[model samples]
Target: MATLAHLSDLHLGSSASAARTLEEAVAALADTELIVVTGDLTENGRTAELAAFDRITAPLADRLVVVPGNHDRCGDDVGAQLMRGVRVDVQVRGGCSIVRIDSTAPHNRVPWLSHGRMCQQVLEQVDVALGAVPDSVMTVVALHHHVVPLPAEGFWEQVSEVLHLPNHSELALGTELLKVLRSRCDLVLHGHRHVPRQFIVDGDSARPLRVFNAGSTTELGAFRTFDFAGGRLLGDPRWHQVTPEPRPSPQVWQAPVCALQLA
Candidate 1:
């Protein structure tokens, strides 16, 4: 079995608090075998912000598997340049096959939209990559946008709902992506909503696909770890919290309950 540390939405360069939170979280991940970051490494995809991210994560670079988020593609194409235009990156590490997909909306087409979509070309790439992976290995798909809908848990999320904002925090082609991933991948990991959640998507003739949405590691002081063996999750993922400073009293927190199951 192998262990994977999942982190998302660091939003570095957004504030000093965010940087501190990420530093603490990274410090706590000394024992993890592999680290997976879903996206939003920066608040505005600026060169300086990317540089800061590189500096902070330098120690963990060898084991990190990352993909770009909407925020990472916002102002400039630096994120894309950094990633070298590879939309589907497949890596086999520690007995697990990880497929990282870029789900950010095209900046040239939708400059102002926060919603993400997987184009036909990207979907085909995903299909080809998954087809190449052996069935014996545990398969995982990581991306920036949530394929499954999550509840409005934060203040901004609630406000967006109240305003009925179109395409706010949405994956425009998520259902189509789900159709492609449900039967092929054992686990789907993402972090766009900044709310930690887990759910199962059952396929008609294949095993259920487990989906985990990681909360913001920097903003919400949250991350998770999962164990996989024989192409299955071992147990409930352990939820962890990182605070900028030590609290006088130890605080208790529970993992977010699975809100929805799709058939």
Candidate 2:
């Protein structure tokens, strides 16, 4: 089976101690085929913070799958542009197609999400990436947001507050994105809400179309691991928390189900 390690929400340079989270995650990803960093690479898109994260992840630089998070684009220059657009990074090795899509919101801190409509555009780009996949190769989609609603338990409450601040009607959700995804893909992986979760959108009995979201690596120090064979999810998802201590915080929440498979 081919194994991939996933992590997200690394708010680099947030607090002086946040670097420890990066170290813990890097240590955990030693043997994985590839590393998927969903988003929140930097706290405020500061060059200093990005530099710090770059140094930390340098060991896996060649094998890294990177995407921008809301926090990473809150600053200036290239960081701002990265937030407004979606980036597609494809890795073709051993005949497997692993695509990383940078699904970050626009960098305008007005009301709700800045680039809600960008998801559609990103999906369009993803279609092009999928075309490159061989008939027998596996395709994995990576992003920085939850395309599916996670369990309520205070997770969405915090997100709702952040994304819905100063505006309250529509939210930048991923349901529309998922509807499109269900038709042409094998698995969707993402992270942003700082909670770990896995759900079978096409039904539990299904075989390949699965959605996996990794919890936060910055605040929670947790990640997701998946095993695949011939583009099919072949084993259970391993959810692990990597903090030096096992203490829990308000940001730390349990996933509904540790793992799932969708067809």
Candidate number achieving the greatest lDDT relative to the actual structure: 1
Q: What's the TM-score of each model vs. the native?
A: 0.85, 0.79
lDDT of 2 at 210: 70
Q: Can you tell me which runs of candidate 1 are displaced by over 4 Å?
A: 108-112, 152-165, 203-206, 244-263
Model 1 weakest lDDT span, ten residues long? 246-255
Q: Encode model 1's per-residue lDDT on 1-263: one tens digit a residue.
A: 77888899889878998888887877887767788999888888888888888888778777878888888887764458645778887987767889988887565234446767778888888888988987767888999888766677666667777887644555766767777877678888898876566777773345667788886777667678888788766877776777844322223224444534444
Clashing pairs in 2: none
**What's the lDDT for all of these models?**
0.75, 0.64
Candidate 2 residue spans exceeding 4 A from truth: 77-89, 93-95, 108-116, 151-173, 204-206, 247-254, 258-263
Clashing pairs in 1: none
Per-residue CA lDDT of model 2 for 1-263, tens digit only, reads 77777788778878865788788778877777777787777777777888898899888887777777666667652245443443666766433567776655454332234332244566677777777666466667777766644443364455655675422212254665555556456677776666666766555544346776676676666666777787666676775667876435534445554343222
